[model samples]
Target chain A: METTTLIGQLPEVTAAGVAIKAILILAIISAIAGFGTYLERKVLAFMQRRLGPTHVGPYGLLQIAADGIKLFTKEDIVPQHANSLIFKVAPVITAATAFIALAGVPVFPDFTIPEFVPVLGGTFVPSIASDVNVGILFVIGMMAAGLYGPLLAGMAQANKWGIIGAARTAIQFLSYEVVTGLSLLAPIMLVGSLSLIDFNEAQSGGFTSWFIWQQPVAFVLFLIAGFAETNRTPFDLLEHEAEVISGYATEYSGMRWGMFFIGEYANMITISILAAVVFLGGYNDFGFIAGWIMILLKVAFFFFLMLWVRAAWPHVRPDQLMWLCWKVLMPIAVINVVVTGIVMMV
Target chain B: MENFLASLFTFQGFAFYLFSFLTIILFWITVMSNNVLYAMTSLASGMVLISGFFFILGADFLGVVQLIVYVGAVMALYSFAMMFFDATREIKEKNTNGAVVFVLGGLSALMLVLMFAAPIHSESIQALYPMHEGVGNAQDVGIVLFTKYLVPFEVAALMLLVAMIAGIILAGKKMDKSLTEMMDEDAGEDEILTQKDEK
Candidate 1:
């Protein structure tokens, strides 16, 4: 009777656990988004062989905090001619959507609320806010939702260039999304589970056990798609200052501009987490605390690499970006999916 | 039956209903939006909702595929096309048709009716249990795809190859005549002017 009582409540407990996990994950994502600025300022100095930002605090750790206060206390201004609703809503949406997408991810093996929760009756497995079982789909939806921030920002600005920039950004993001999807599909088939936790667990056994080894082609395609989807270097044709002049982010100021920055950083972090979870082993570095450490380092490394690429490479043509997705990434991804499926099956 | 009923009453189950409702609304918005970019957003939302439904069905692979492929790839395609074409030309690019819409509506209605009635006319309804086919694990999916489904897999590859060839031919032909020809024309004109001046 006791066993059945416990078993009966397992579903509810799990559900509550998921809910708690979702909140914690979102908070972590928010902190990372806020802290990443500090990390960048400090790191840029080492990379450029020059002192980046000093005097704010030791190594300018307080620089980001100081900047935050300045932006927050500064006068909030809206152009009299702007679309009030969308303009105001875009930035918050951008940041919120980016953070929302982080819910499906599992940071530590047991970190996502425990599988079950204890209740007076027994234990139950409640869903984290948006597990959706189709979590990959949710992530995609949320990421795509983030794009609206730029779209609306441009539209609200009512400037010709702003509109054009937004238009170009929309097309660029949509184009890359296909390659990202196809690239992600290869792994979905490999793990055979949509759950992020399932995918993470499958990637356990050290380097040899990683999915990247099993599916190198997919990994390459995913990286390329990730670059384009986020509007990073080589795929940063949307903003090509020589041409579009900052893409959809033109005319953004204060917190509004910060939203775009936050969104980009959030996406970068999310993708790095994905790279670690899907390809590199997440939270499984063979030692006690190593998994968490390794995942963090790996994510930071990839994100820094993205920044490095941003500083190093020049922009690509809009047409070239499209052709690369359809011609290069998409085709390769499809083939990889086929091959991976065939090999795994065999 | 009891477990199935339990799932329907549970929190996870309730969330599914919410996701489905949101998905349906977004899907319509996507279909209704005149702007291609807006349409893509809506479509992405719809796919997300469908992915949630897949989660309810316990098909983990299918759910992720829906998210990664639909959101990551298909939505991207829509956005890219919108960006390339300049989504501002919504008024000019009204290529939609009413006749096609009605036909699609009728066809979908027929499909819906057939699907709804499928269980009513068959023994399949009486034995409605989760089909825990051997196709649960990666290995299982692999074996089936390589062996039993080998021919279809090969066919997909062949189709992809044909598409590639067609794309190359089409792309090459278009570029050679227009941008390249125009570029060469100005150079040729400059050279002729220079030659005449020198003479």
Candidate 2:
């Protein structure tokens, strides 16, 4: 179908619906990000053969709430020599960009409110909020912008460790960004559209149609880039306590620190969703499973994989990280794109 | 009153005005701020708001590129460099050459006037590649860029490549020795010099 009409055929998303959807995303995702901390701890603990957060509530479920309370109630501290303004704004940038990137990501399938609903009865909410034509690029761009959070934070805080962290953030983020963009380019070439919805629709066919099967190299490259982009284990050199003392977050405390935590978890979720949608069959159904469930499972698996890798692998040195990005991942991604283009031509 | 408010506050118009207001304030800060870090931050934000104008104009692709290229890469690199300098200190510069400043300002104004006037003065200005109806904004831009402006695009890429290589050549002169190893060598020499003096 024509691209224009494809959008036109979708039910009109009223302003109220959009607003409601935005709020839903913000509330639910923030909650999920909080819950993710709990889940990560549990998963990591399980891997280490230990109990994690058992005192908070039954099976440590309400540990999220307890942690939230602690973060909220903790005193906000600013170091004496720190640049106060930028230091304060740094975590906000991180959290805001992570959430903003979600605006282009479709977390769940679109649905309309029932007529019985009071304010937004029969209102249609899109899966992807806004649904801009350049969804993939916009999402990637916002995530790229998120590097400022750690970069500014480390710079603002007047600590030698923080400065070192900031320098690492600059090099790591800048280098990985090229890998991320190049890795995604091959899948984008096959899809012929930048919109995530189009990517989903293109793979509506079954498991065989998944881009992961066709562009396995791109999928692996994207996953590696995603791990680095999200600052997960092995690449978590940005805040490795053993090296730079929490890196950019060395001086942050209380809610400001919590914001950074939330931002990191949100980014993890966003990268997981991107992986599921772009490479895996997205929200497309497998024979026995529903589409929504399939996507949720895919996202959960990727999220779990991040934690598993954290448990399994050792962090690379700063020089090694740079080498992997520039010398290895970047070259492979470029070659993958070239090969994909050639195959398409043939 | 309701009709007047409704007429005055279109979503697009409101967004444009808001972004414009923020952009102007940010640029003002970029120019007037004493601290280098503050000036850099404001400049980066101003660039982002400029991209907001592109989004408001329905150029989604351009807005995103502006964000990724300028705010993401360029400004981050600037901040990285700022880390080396004492960014906490206020920057002080003398404004002694008023005549040179005035001449440069006048030249820029004249250039801006010419830029605005050129479009109006042309008799039959037409889009070399008219936008296709069913295509998205990105695809339309890609089509025009590849087909109509291919030569200029390739030339620009080549120019950038030359500049990049030149930059590497200039920066990579001392690439053989690692910074840590050099520092260690200096420490070792200091220790040896102290031992020789004692002997």
Candidate 3:
């Protein structure tokens, strides 16, 4: 697995064997995804002045791990009325899409390790699955693949309520996805390259240098659309337990339910990283590791904000959801796009 | 060993095989299916399978655009029409008379031979095969579409408008009812236009 470094310096080391590298990346991401769930509940609990999970482990760190074991061991029951094939595949689809999403993300600068366990001092290489020049388009297309997950889950579950939930999901996805694409368009225009590294470098200067400053309208639209994309409360129509009883996830229980839940939080994490990259100067800070820390803080902040909004607001009506997107968010996003285009060109 | 298998079931080789299989299934249904709607759906499926082959060939934009435009839009519209016509098992075979069937069978044979017999040449559609191998930026696509492909792009747009107009006309008397209800729902600036048109 020996390869030349980007700087054409000394060859890097290999702590991890070649055969195990990609598998390790996938395993780590899956583990981290489960861990993120624990972080969300603990953080949310603390903000609410509760002890979170004193029973599970120290500060509830083992909650997600315990839950993970419980989920895997649970029975995957299929409803007699359901189209079992599509139902079974739906959760797996929802889960795997995020890892492919990692391909387009940059966890560390120039750190995509073709060979793991670096030859030199721990700088592996670029931290992406692919150094795709057209990374942004791939991300969007991947995002579309994500829409089928919930749609299939809802449809294949075969409840009348499930059909309604699926329809809501489809309509909701169509509407909010428009805003997400529109908002991202401004940044794409700003950076001109579809590469994440290129986008990262565009935000290099400092706090003042962030794209958020130059394109505040685009920034606001992105955050709002990001909220809807993750289906966090205020925007979470997909799983309102009180009304429609779990929306698209009505019939799912045990590990199947857990998969959907974790997939959701992982999607939130992915979008959090993306929003940080595009608008908030991803891993770029006032000083050294401060940039990376800044991104972490921003991500945690967005995660917390989602929790607060969840507790704070009620779900909107299905018709209202479509109207909000088509009438409100889409128009605002369109305006942001035009203004961003004019500003960039001028 | 790896190269041999890679060459044998080469990504392109498997993709082409899949495409041909689907195409055969589609044409078989196109002739034999009891429902016209199934034939149309099969046709769209076949087309999309071909587009997947296009991706294997590394014609990334062509593959995506083919799926987006044909499978997504064109086929969707065709399905809407088929739905409107109430596509059932009976009427799909409605037009497949002995004479018509013979003519279409002869045409299909001619098409199959022509397609296979065409001189095989390769400019390497494998341009974007390994994923992320295409000029993506939207800017590249924009430039090519607006500059070199401008005439065709404009022509496509004009053709779309014509098709839409034809669709509206063919869609019939119920269109007024649907349009007015939609107009009622969106009773804004367009209401005035609809009111004037109604008179």
Candidate 4:
């Protein structure tokens, strides 16, 4: 009776509406992830004072479509000595885990479909696909599980470079995961709930109430860890081209390689959204700006920050990467968590 | 057909059965696979599916913990160890002593019997932290753990710390020397030994 009442107070979302929302999120996020590649190229080119992909469309807007066509048409190659099953499954794991992480993330605010819209008309669609109570932990866990993609891919290919890449993937992901969880602990404590919705609500007071102001150390640690987790520049030793060819992706081609790229870009979006929601005021309205627009700007800022960092920064050596994670980031995160706990108690 | 579809989609029993079936199959694969990589992968996946059982039971925190600790960190560490070996090569079990197998089998059987018997005998067992209405899963878990189970938790943490220190001590024998420096030193020693023998 109590449980029913509690659940009753929440917004009424239909199963069909959730399915529609999930499909929309999957479709839109994937398109955005693809488009992100084009954006990165354009941004990087602009940074380097060169035109990027301008021949394809106006300002290279159609390059994503061209890349998609190229990826589909290219022959998928599997090496003879490769572990055939795992080799085939690796990229899928990467892509699947990435999208699964997004399920817990609230990409947009809730909205009800118009009554005029046929089958799913008048249905309320939630921002989050499944609002598990342990939302933050769930997202982190799913992303951490994505380590298998590169790890297995590297090992399955039977290449020395691939093995090295896989080894790097294991260490890089494992170490950063500690920092990621610890850094987020401060915000989780402040909000006193793991749900992203709750985190958003806690910060609804306005921009000044954002967790970033309170736990700036955590925010920075999380951002650094996010970059590492997404295999972005500086921490992208997993597939560092200069050192390890294409790393784990050396033997992969066509859509298989493209899947890894998709997973990476998708992870980038997930991290960006996480930072936006957790550190920034999430989907809360600013003084002059709307809630949804504020969130979009925040997510875009984070996404662009990732690209900017890539252009500005150079790759860290594997040793330096580990050192930074364990020595610098982890310690700072733990300290921040402890301080937050003490302050809360006081 | 419509009723069947509705029941299949809505029934918790169906999900439970499906998850259990998959978990059993994955564990069986873990035990029976010849390749170490396949075995390890199956074990990891089976562990993940077991977390589904936790989720089904409404232990959301436990389920996510299982995912992070077992599927993510622990299994990733195992796979990292696996990379040192030729993972694609088939593993062969050479020795199968009948008497030792019988002893281990008997021990396992006794343990399983105890496991089943304990739950049946302990009918009076109560939850330390009974599920509170309107409380989130993580909060309930945290309250119970920090209140009732604090001592055990701290002990476990201390145990982990000890083990971690031991691991570092064991692994950090040549911490002062770089890999190249150590290799060069060994090479020089070898040359010195060879020169002494020649003289």
Candidate 5:
């Protein structure tokens, strides 16, 4: 009786729900982006056999908070030659696009507020924010659109390093985006839906039902492309410190710089989530566990894996990055899609 | 505030107004900005606002495609702005040909009038032909493009292929000469550095 009552009283998914979801997503993701930096430092330090950020709160738990304060309090600097408006707006575009891409991602399992809760009782919260039908395409497009941030930031600064950075940003993002799209295509074909939630459901049967087993090539290609897409290590020639001093970000300072950092971390999370949902069995409970917890674990594993790779490997040069993207990854992804179509037809 | 937000999120009447307002503002910015980079940025945002309109109108596939193709592929003008032109240089619009501008304005005005006047008839025509059953937006678009518009789709694809080949040839022709020039410049830079060290 209580369950039925709660179900009946549940608030429909109105505009109000969208507003609440947007707020929750923005707050949680920005916080996660901050926390991710601390985690990355800790993990990379451990891999190198050193203590990382142990000065702040316990295990440097409050380090992100400290960093946040510093970032906020620091003076905002715009170079004399810089295009001030775009230089300022560019970081915001980065951060905004990164956060916007999360709208289609199913971050958690759906849930409802209990009937006993006060004014907001029986409100149903979905796994995703918008849950648009064309979820994956939208996410990829939004992330690709984030190229403007680095491109504009680089040119506006009037620095040679910034120009090189912007040029690399364009080449790397555009090329890898092809691999990213093609690599994901085989899986999308198999699942027959672009919605991340649908992808999750398609794999919910078991580990054996996962698309990774069938489309392993595509999964690996997707992983590599994703790393490049997020400008992670091994493909992060856009900002290799020895070659370019922080690249396009050399002229930015304070919160503006922090926004770029947050945007990068958010994109990492978005890629991790996408990989987990599409390749690994997403949000599906194992033998005896709950779904949401399993999804969390999967996402955490991908996150750690990124940090681990950063610690272990050096980044590729710009030429090598392009060569790998076009000659190596793109062709393989194309073949994978053709093979997938053949097998499905058979 | 709550009600306003509720309506905005639902994308009722207010949502359309907001999108239209942004689109108009961005359109003006795109045209009126003197900085080429800023103009490109505004144009991109204006395109995005148009996609937002498509999304609100329930054409999810078209919206995503607009983002991917127009915003993602074509509007990579930032690189050109960086490479070919001075991004920070002020663009003086001195060549405002009055006759051409007048004719273009008249044509666009006429088109707009026709669009508004024939809206009812177009709405009826749209209602007369609905999408096929048992498919989502993407699939619906795919089916129509493959079946009904197959010849036109293939023709577009061929045109794109020709364009891609032309671009590759043009870019490749420049690469060989530039590569040699870059190597010579690098050697010169190294020589200068060594001479400085000796001094």
Candidate 6:
């Protein structure tokens, strides 16, 4: 009878366990987002042959903390004519949605707490917060929903530049979302499952087993579309300061602005995680290393690649960005999907 | 208190109640908001909440599709609202439609109550495809969608294509006028140049 009761309590314990994991993931990921800004500045500076943020701490490690304090102490300003409520809520939406999407992502391998612990002992925590069988779709849907942040923020501020930025945000996000979906579809078809865990297991053998080998075109399309989705360089038209004066974020200040920044970096991390998990081998071990470590290495490489691309490339014109998405990348993605389907039949 | 909270959480009815509450509230917000943007936002929220119901009911594929379609793709409604109306200004709803609104609202509420009271557990009700234990929801939905509902699916796809064509044609009409005006101006300029050369 005691054993049965203990077994009955298993689901509750696991639920509590995952809830804890979700909180931990949120805290750690947001912190990493803060640290990522520092990494960006340092990496960009080095690429340009200059030192970046050397004074704050050793190699500017504490710069994120300094930036955090500054942002916290800074005056929270709301424009006189602005729709204050929506403007204020907008950044939170961006940040919150980004974190919420992280719930579906498997950041690390699953683990169980030791039985030596008190109340929550022997509870198993899955790598993902909620493994909701429709994992990829849920994550992508959440990310797509994140478009509202910039959309509402720009409109609420009532600035002309902000309006233009918001319009761009709408068009850009909507367009690339199609490509993102289409490019991912082929791989999803190949895997025959939408669950990220299944995708991970499909490529568990080695680098040779990665989807990038089977569906290189899809991989390339996804990467290009991802760059746009994350609002990264070469497609950063939404906030190209030269043209649109900071775009959707022109009027935002203080921690409100910091929230948008965090949202952006968090999105970057999500894209990287998706690419690693979907195209590259995800949480699967190399010859010598463990699965978790291998996953981390893959994630780190993708993160570094984003920074590198940002440093190396120049921003594209909005027209060019639109042309590429609609005229070029999209057609390629559709063909790739068709070819993949035909190949599968054979 | 702890037990109450635990019971509230662990009860299956709690999720249904929570999702239904959200769906009703957001639906009301969508209908009643004076601001077009707010109305559209709430509409999207309500749609998402509806998807939440699907998720809770174990129709994961349907839930995701609902989100991707209703929340994501159908945001054309939002863009139209933003473009056609001044979003910041409140729309003054005329009092002339008060009786119509009241009757409609009442009828909807009555219908909802009737729906709630209906015997969903009736013995005659049966699932088309019996649950194949261990098969994922997506595969099940795919099997049914492709095999049984293929005609309906194709019709839906055709409807979407027609909608796309209509949207393109509507947008193209606006561009045509400007292009013609520019062509006329160039033609007049060419006439003037030719006349000057003859002189």
After superposition, the stretches of candidate 5 with alpha carbons farther than 4 Å from their true spots are A1-11, B1-10, B94-96, B127-129, B174-199
lDDT of 3 by residue, A1-346 (tens): 1231122343342433222344555676677678877766776777778867778877767787788888888887888867676678778767776656665675433343344545633535444545455666555555555655676677667675665566666666666777877888888888987666677788888788899888788888877777777787767777777677877788887888777776777677778778888888877655645555677787777777777776567778766777788788788888888887887779
Considering every candidate listed, which one attains the maximal lDDT?
2
Looking at model 4 chain A, report the run of 10 residues with the lowest lDDT sum: A1-10
Cα lDDT tens digits for candidate 6, A264-335: 888888888899999998877777677777778888898888889999999887767877998898999999
How do all the candidates rank in terms of lDDT, highest first?
Answer: 2, 4, 5, 6, 1, 3
Cα lDDT for residue A306, candidate 5: 92
Best model per DockQ: 5
Q: Stretches of candidate 3 above 4 Å error?
A: A1-25, A46-51, A108-125, A290-294, B1-6, B9-113, B119-140, B155-199
lDDT of 6 at A231: 89
Point out the higher-scoring one by TM-score: 3 or 4.
4
Which wins on lDDT, candidate 4 or candidate 5? 4
**Model 6 C-alpha lDDT per residue in residues B1-199, reported as the tens digit of each score:** 7854775686555887788888889778887888876777778778877888888778888898888888665466767776887766688877767889899889998998887676555577677797688898889988888999999999999999999899889877755455567778799789999999999
DockQ pick, better of 3 and 6: 6
Q: Candidate 3 DockQ category?
A: incorrect
Q: What tens digits encode model 2's per-residue C-alpha lDDT throughout B138-168?
A: 8989888898899999999999999999998
Please, what are the lDDT tens digits per residue for candidate 4 over residues A1-346? 2211112355686788689888988898889889999999999999999988998888889999999999999998999988989899999999999999999988776777889998878887877888898999999999988888898898888898998898888889777989999999999988888988889888888879999999999999999999999999989999999999999999999999999998998898899889998999888778867777777888899889989999999999998888899988888888898999999999
Off-target runs (Cα >4 Å) in candidate 1 are A1-13, A70-93, A108-157, A167-171, A174-221, A240-242, A287-289, A319-346, B1-13, B20-24, B27-43, B72-130, B133-172, B176-199
lDDT values, one for every candidate? 0.69, 0.87, 0.67, 0.86, 0.84, 0.84
In the predicted model 6, the residue pairs found to clash are: none
| DockQ values, each candidate | 0.20, 0.55, 0.12, 0.56, 0.56, 0.45
Model 1: how far residue A225 lies from native, Å = 3.6
Please list the Cα RMSD from the true structure of every candidate, rounded to 1 decimal place: 7.4, 3.7, 8.1, 4.4, 4.3, 6.0
Kindly list the per-residue Cα lDDT of model 1 for residues A97-134, writing each as its tens digit. Answer: 78787765544334322335444233332323455445
Model 1's DockQ score: 0.20
Deviation from native of the Cα of residue A191 in model 1, angstroms? 6.2
lDDT of 2: 0.87
Cα deviation of A131, candidate 4, in Å: 0.4
